[model samples]
Target: MHQARETDIDGAALLAKLNGWARSLGFSQIGVADVDLASAEPGLMAWLERGFHGQMHYMAAHGLKRARPAELVPGTVRVITARMDYLPHTAPAGWQQIEFDRLARPLDATVSLYARGRDYHKVLRARLQKLADRLAEEIGPFGHRAFTDSAPVLEVELASRSGLGWRGKHTLLLSREAGSSFFLGEIYVDVPLPLTESTPAHCGSCRACIDVCPTQAIVGEYRLDARRCISYLTIEHDGPIPLALRASMGNRIYGCDDCQLTCPWNKYAKRAVLPDFDVRSVFDAPTLLALWGWSEADFLRHTEGSAIRRIGFERWQRNLAVALGNALRATGDADIAQALQGRRDSATALVREHIEWALAQRPQAC
Candidate 1:
């Protein structure tokens, strides 16, 4: 490990410098967290035991190492957590209502706002590395590693510990200044930086996030059943989506933002300082039929530099098929039926099953 130089370091001054560099790099905020995360282990174990993580085997595979950052990265004494607001600057003041309105449109494909732009993993990871490099240039070399949702790191735990914000009832980091419309990145470093004070949670008596869930994925406050989560069903779970949850998924083809959309704190969500988070044109107002029209090559070409591409074409088609099914059930649109029929024979087995299910959907008599 290339340790930081043995010199008298002013922790406060170093933090100030870090904040400045972070802001200049499109980071909204930066905080330091001590590596002793033993307190969070029991909760981690319980969540895993409940199988709430669904198909994300990696969460269980990492075991308690996720809470023990020092074990994950030897010589790590503090984790520097970063917050980058991801709401596109073009978002209108009543954006929450706008999103809710979008969800009501059964034919429109609704993606999680975060995944609408450039892949956040690529954006945050590169920026975090540059931040680490800047620190190294200032105080000589240091043993450090950067992570942005790419590892088994207890990201929200570390971020909350570092005073980024309190954990919202929906299990996402929420800030008074930025809400939960942001991405978090971390730099595990050997530097003994001053720890930031964790903020008090402000969820109060609100149950908006819990009530608005399409599939009741948030079984309780701060407890998400990933198995039922639209985000997980569409993005993480690589098998057939549960029969019960498909209709509730509505037109969310990529990820669901219903929880975040309903959170009162999100009214304060900040816009991204960098253009990297600007919504891609293809995703801006995509309809289920329009996206269903994309061939595998078109899907690949369009999703280049996108997080959506990581799911591959098969899952993409599968998600769209489910959404089209729900749209057909809701509107009985002939065009949607035609689109599903056109793709049925050519679709992979997984997608074909969903397409078949879609073709079977008919509007119920009221």
Candidate 2:
């Protein structure tokens, strides 16, 4: 617990100092938001009702508490929303074109670029706490809580209202200058900081993102059916992927970036200012057979600080199997054939089933 000075600090001056601290901490922008997320409640309930959240039962378990920030974090009067650009410094100059080209291959495994390095949850949460600690130094003792995609809260709505960026049609916060390739974090505090005006949506008649989605997960403007979303299928959903959308998933082994790649604003996507987001070697254009060779220990060691670890080794194999199946169908390579054959006896039934599926796609000559 930290305390704030009893002698009230000038709100504007305090905000300026907070921004400076946030920038130093690698946050691209910081905005204060009021807790009145009343408008989002209906959409939240509807999304849950549709079972769009998939196996993430926690989304429904939290109920309306997600809309009530004060309920989740007591004494929270204002929410400090922060954005950190995550496009890796090593990302190619025409990264969007490269990503789209990779997707076109349908056989090349495409892990979302964001997950190819360290887990953003750990990175952003640590920095958000640092920002909170810095605020404590300025204002003395104050009740505050920090969150980075920890759920039980509507982060994007909070961020949009706080002027971080407008919610694009893809339901991701998009900026004319920054695009949608960033991570968001929040600090719920007792202090009532000045709120910033919301940015208006600039996505007029453009529907490139909607048209480009292979799964048709973006049901409409600002609405996503997570059940059909590859990110949810690969990362959030625990069971086997829905049969209907499996082939449509292409070679997205971990997460999907088609929506973000198709967004025109992403042309301006900036490289990460911090080295924390640099792409790791394991994720640097590895072949499906190469990644499928990792043992459980190898998987844990390689992804120790990465978001991919959360999917666990079994799911990791399952996803890789799907991508390998696609690769096998595309290239008819003997290595992919041998790799699928090698994994058929995997201990996990889920992994075995996926391996069997991959083996089924093998050409008759094999």
Model 1, CA-based lDDT: 0.92
* Model 1 CA lDDT for position 75: 81
Model 1 ranges off by over 4 Å: 3-7, 364-366
Give a tens-digit lDDT track for model 2, residues 1-366: 233213366888988999999999999999999998888999999999998888889999999999999888776778999999999998878898888787777446688989988899999999999999999888776888999998797999999999988999999999888999999999998887888889999999999989988899999988899989999999988888776777787788899999899899999888888887888988877666778889999999999999999999989888888888777876778888787887787548888777777778777775
Highest TM-score against the true fold, candidate: 1
lDDT of 2 at 328: 80
Q: Pick the candidate with the highest lDDT.
A: 1
**What is the C-alpha lDDT profile of model 1 across 1-366, one tens digit per residue?**
455334478889988999999999999999999888999999889999999999899999989999998889888888999999999999999999998899899999999999889999999999999999999999888889999999999999999999999889889999999889999999999888889999999999999999999999999888999999999999999999999999899899999899899898898999999999999999999998889999899999999999999999999999999999999998988898888999988888999999999888966641
Q: After superposition, how far is residue 356 of candidate 1 from its true place, in Å?
A: 0.9
Q: Residue 303: error of model 2 in Å?
A: 0.6
| Clash count in backbone of candidate 1 | 0
Cα miss at 330, model 1 (Å)? 1.0
